[model samples]
Target chain A: MTSWQIIILASIAVFALKLAGYLVPPSLLERPRPARIANLMTVALLAALIVVQTLGAGTRIVFDARVPALIVAAGLLAVRAPFIVVVAAAATTAALIRLLT
Target chain B: MSTARSSQHKAAIRASVAVGIAVSAYGISFGALAVTAGLDIVQTCVLSLLMFSGGSQFAVIGILASGGTAAGVAAIASSTLLGTRNALYAIRMAPVVGGRWPRTLLAAHWTIDESTAVSAAQTTPEGQRAGFWWTGAIIYLGWNLATLIGALIGNLLGDVSQYGLDAAAAAAFLGLIWPRLKSMQPIAVAVGAAVVAALLTPALPPGLPVLAAALVAVVVGLTNWLGPKDPLPAMQQLDLGEDGFP
Candidate 1:
């Protein structure tokens, strides 16, 4: 299928999911699993995104200075460093280490 | 139900849309990277439009380019699996939209990362709905436009790193994730998931490790290892009133 076709199909599917969620009553959403899963999903999704970004350097998982980048980024976040500083520090650290090592 | 609340709703909508714009612009990095990786303009845009899920979109293209079809499929599956949470957001947000067809369409498009966060943060039902639609529309339009522009300019650029475009989305994502680490459970979950994802990276493909990490997070939260009661505060408990937005 063409990209447009794929997009249209996917859009429809996503819309359907939204619609289903809308139609379902809120009481159902109060289920332990839904609530539990939802909360878990939030943190997990963010973690997944971060992990993928830090590890996958153009298709391969380079465990070089990226590890240090990850650690530094997490530490900065832990210590409440400004967002831009934390990210710039991490990326610059990674690149410099890559160049050096 | 009240004018004051409606106004607050409007304000929340504006905030969500603004935040959406700020976040969605980061997609330029993804668009540029995808094209640099050999994906056509249409293919990259379609991933954004169809997948509409950022992590999965990146994972699919990343794996497909890496010659890891099986791993790519796994990544896509895992990311989509993690994406199930957005549906839950829809459940909470549906009441705010209240079956208005135009609003429903808006809600459908706006059910993304930023909008969900905005909606969850609001107290009033009206404000929540307003946030859901406004933020959703902003992200939808902003992301598409950025993707198109990024594809055009990104295709012309030699190395994306030269422009520092490669780190833009990661930076933006970190900005979003960093602010939410309020307490121990979330902090623990984030740390654990990151560690797991890192450990799995060399062993798995681009998306799999993250997904696995997310799965572990799910288990931790479900088992009360993450917290005792709900981590998210009940913003509605105070009876902010039908018209009061706070």
Candidate 2:
């Protein structure tokens, strides 16, 4: 597919996705099951996504110094360090790893 | 008369822009990387603008580069699945919008993970609504602009892998998820998913394992197999007080 086609398709898909939110009756959101699913889904999906992004890139875990960055990021997060710090620790760790290895 | 409320909103706008700038910088890396992966500049920018979801975009390009049609579908499916979480957030935020259609429209447009977190953390209703709208808008604008800029510069950037830009997107995702592990259940889910995905990384494509992991998370959550002792007390109580920002 051409770039335009991909863009158009994806845009339409996203709009449709957003529309679901607007169209759903607010009452449904009040239910315990749906609310439970919503809250759990964020953490669940996020965790899952991070795993795929970090470890699964076509094969073999890319566990080099990058893993250490995650370790530090998790540690900072554990301490409830500021958001900026957590991000910086990860980015800086990765950057240093790239520079060194 | 609520000067504090107005000021907090102002701070949210600025913070959103900051996040926008940071997140958009990665777009340059993505754009540059996509070009190297056989995507023309236009294709790269289009993915950024329309899909607007980083994980899925990376999955699509990665699959296409590897000649994997299924990869594209898997990536899109997983992304849409993850993106669905934003819809739930929208539902939660709706009441705070106070039935203002125009504001809702804008809120709907800009709603994303980062903006939602900020808005959800606000203590007041007005603050929540304002934070949601302003943050979402600024991030959206910044992200698109960054994508365009990144695409333009991508042609000039050679071998981004040397700088580890290839993994930068993943690294950013780590930053996003790390802050959310507030309890044992979340941490366990994260570790479990990561280990499983890592184990399956070689057997699967870039995005499939992620989709699988998400499925696992949902199942685990549904079964209540393990995790914190259900902090969601009064799950349906709608006590706007506790809802007053986490």
Candidate 3:
């Protein structure tokens, strides 16, 4: 399939998944375990994304500016800095580091 | 009605708008990155409009960028998996977003992280409604608009990496999940999954590593080992201040 086909098909599938939740029998979801698992799965996926974005370099793990920059972002988040602040600071930190080295 | 109650709703709405604006600004990064990742300006905006979930949107671009054209299936699978939480969120919000089929259908489109966090933060049903709809509408409008702007800007940039776009993406994902790390169990799950994914990144394809890492959450969550005595989904206890910003 072409890029357009892939994107269009994926978008529709995601929407359908979202709608399925609303239409499903609440009794099945009410079990709580499924909900718990779903929530945990989200965390897991996000954590994986963070690692991949920051370190993974196409089948190779390369240490680079993103590591220190991510740490800076974490520090800001720890202090309760706003969302935009963390993101901007991270980007700026990486940019500065890359420029210097 | 009590003035206090009205004020409560007002606060929720205010926060919703603030979150809307904040989350919407992040769309610029996505727009720029998506364009740089080979998606045209129109495709970028279409994604923001249709998928509507930030994590899923980012995953599509990120996977495609990493694994090249052959990674199309992985991109779709990873993006869909990311949307799983939204589906779960829908089940939780069904009662909160009650209406006819039409309204609920529309609500499903807006069933995203920021709206859910803001709504769950409220003390009253009216406040929840206000928070959900207001945040959803603001983000929906602002994200699409910002995507266009970012796409335009991305066309001018030479290299996104020099400007730390990659780092920003990582930081954004980190910040998004930061709020959900309320306890030891989820923290362990997050760390476990990260390690697993990192280890598998060199071995498996781009998107498969993320899918593989999901087992960490499933096993830990199912076993209830290193979990809380009361197994709550954590959505009901969402503190809006720390929630994953869309």
Candidate 4:
């Protein structure tokens, strides 16, 4: 399928998912187990995304500029730096590493 | 309206607008990175408009950038999985946005993190409505405009890696989810998932590792359910007062 088709289908799916939330019985959502999983899903998926983006390159895990940049980002985040600062710091760290090397 | 009530409403508006502008700064990066990641200007804008969720859009683009063989499928799956949280958000927002189907549908379209956070922060239903609509409108406008500007700039400055825009995707993702790691359980879950994905990258396909990592959450969730009762973690509390900025 083409990119546009993929986007269109995904758009419909997303809207359906959002709308389903309103339709689902509150009893299901209020359950402790599903709620717990839903909460952790964000953290887990994001972590997986970060790991893949930073370390993976076409099925090979390699260390590169993103590793240090991510370290800087994690540190800034640990300190509760503003969102903009975290992005700028990470980008600058990666850019400077690339420049120096 | 009374002066005090008017002041409170004004404060909610100011807060919502501030969140909108702050969120838009990330949109500029998303726009530029999406183009660099092989999406056209129109595709990027449409993704932002329809998918309408930053994390999911970034996930899709990130998969594409990583050279996934089935990039489209991977993108959609990851995006769909990441978007499930919006359903949870909608559950919390349903009571607050009670109206006819048309209004509720519009509210559902706007049921994103920032809008939900701002609306949940309000004390009154009116203020909640104000917060939700204003944040949604400003973010929609600001995000699309920034996306256009960034895409134009990115298209002009081809080969975005020279400026380290390549790493911007990961950086942006980190910036987004970092604030939510307020407690140990979430941190542990993130660490565990990262480890699982890192280990699985060599053996599995591009997207499967991410999907596989979700099992860790499922296991944890199930264990929590079967085990003795424990206090709710910060993440599960859904306290908007501490949600901070978008």
Candidate 5:
């Protein structure tokens, strides 16, 4: 499938999951395992994404400007900076690091 | 509507608009990142409009940007896995979004973290519904609009890597994950999964590492090995055996 097809397919699949929840038996909610696992997977997957996007270039893992940028991002987040600030700071930090080194 | 309901509606609208604007402003980052991830402006906008789930949309673009579709269906799998939380959200939101057919369908689309959170914060049933509807509407509009704006800006800024948009993508993920890292188990999930995925990245294919690392989370989560020592009350624990797989 093309990129468009892939994106659309994903959208439909996710929407279907959401719609199914409304239609399905609420008894599923009684079982906390599935929901908890889902939550846990979200956390895990996101953390993994951070690692991949920061360190991986294609299949090769290269430590570069992104590491300090990510550290800055984490620091900004720790200080309760707004979302946009955190993101922009990360980008700027990386750009500056690359420019200098 | 009674005076109380009307007041509740007013309050919900106020709260929703505030959060909606703040969160939607961040959509620009997503838009910029998605386009940097190889999606066109149209594709980026369509994604936010349709998927409307921040984490899942990021997953889609993140995968696409790195290895293209050559990653072998990992994009869809990871994106859908993230969207699974919306299904769980819908369970809590069904009654708040109570209705039939088209209305319910729309509610499902809006059954996301922000709207659910706004609704859950309310004390009254009316307030909950009002919060859900208001937050969903504002966020839907603001998020899509901001996505368009970001996509346009991203298009103008060629060669995104020099601008560090790649790092911005990772930072975006960190931003999303930050709030959830409150407990030992979740912290363990993040640290373990990150290290494992990092370790596996060199050996495995582009996307496989992340997927494989998710197993670590499943193991840690299922075992509850690092979770709080305080047990669930007996009634809740009745079903969970020693293995704690369930």
Candidate 6:
């Protein structure tokens, strides 16, 4: 299929998945196991995304300035720094590293 | 609304606006990148409007940018995988938003990470609804506007990497997730997922690694459910309320 077709189909699928979540029985969602998994899934997925975004470029995983930038972001987060500060600090760290090297 | 509730709503709105703007900053890059990746301005906007998921939209553009032969399939697969988390968000949000079809349909479109997080952070049901709607509206507006601006600017914003906007998404995600890591279980889960994704990066496809790492949560949840009745102090401390972290 073309990109247009793909986008349309994918949108439908995404909407369906979301609607299914609402349609699910409360009993199923209230179950301890599923609830716990859903709770932790966001954290897991976010962490995974962070790693992939930092390390991977297309299919190639490379250690670039983003590694240090991520470390800086994590440090700022550990200290409970403001969100803007953490983002700016991390971005600056990466920019400076790239500039110097 | 009472004075207290009104203040809470104001605070939620304020926070959501700030996050909306920050998240929209990334949208500028996405718009420019999508165009650079050979998509027309209309197509780029359509992705932002219809797909509406930043990570998945980026995945499609990134695959196209790489000029892969199977870019279509790869983009769809990668984007679909990243979009699954919205379903999880929906499950958590269903009870709070309730079952009105028209409203729920709109809610489904906005059932993204930012709205979900902002809503989940509230202490009241009204606040939850307010948070979700406000955040979703702001993000939708901000993201689309930024996309238009970025697309109009086009390649003028050359080499987004030099400015470190490339890492902006990851940094933003880190900031969002950091506040939620209240105890050991979550921290462990985050670390385990990150490690798994990093390790699998070289072996698996781009988005599949993240999905594979999600299995870690499933495994842990299953273990906690089926295994011996060892009480986890940290898990017990989790506030399983509509207002609490999910």
* Best-matching candidate per DockQ: 3
Q: Give per-residue lDDT, candidate 5, residue A52.
A: 95
User: Clashes in model 4: which pairs?
Assistant: none
Worst ten-residue run, lDDT, model 3 chain B?
B233-242
Residue pair clashes in candidate 3: none
Model 6 chain A is weakest, by summed lDDT over 10 consecutive residues, at A26-35
* Candidate 2 colliding pairs, count: 0
Question: Ten-residue segment with the worst summed lDDT in candidate 4 chain A?
Answer: A26-35
Ten contiguous residues with the weakest lDDT in model 2 chain A: A1-10
Question: Model 3 over residues A1-101: C-alpha lDDT tens digits?
Answer: 46676688778878888888888876756565677777788789889989998998899999999999999999999998876688789989999999999
Candidate 2 regions exceeding 4 Å error are A1-11, A38-101, B1-38, B53-70, B98-106, B121-126, B227-246
lDDT digits (tens) for residues B25-84 of candidate 4:
777777888888888999888988887877777887887778633667877877787778
Cα lDDT tens digits for candidate 2, A1-101: 44455445655665456556665877766544555554455455566555554454456666665566667777776676654456456656766887886
B202 Cα displacement, candidate 5 (Å): 1.2
Total colliding residue pairs, candidate 3: 0
DockQ of 6: 0.48
RMSD of each: 5.4, 5.1, 2.3, 2.4, 5.1, 5.0
Q: What is the TM-score of each candidate against the true structure?
A: 0.73, 0.73, 0.91, 0.92, 0.93, 0.72
Model 2, position B41: C-alpha lDDT score: 80
Rank the models by TM-score, top first.
5, 4, 3, 1, 2, 6
Q: Rank the candidates by lDDT, best first.
A: 3, 5, 4, 6, 1, 2
- For model 5, the stretches where C-alpha displacement exceeds 4 angstroms are B229-246
Residue A84 displacement in candidate 6 (angstroms): 5.3
Q: Tens digits of per-residue lDDT for model 5 on B103-165?
A: 998999998888877777777898899889998999899999999999998888879789999
Docking class of 3: medium
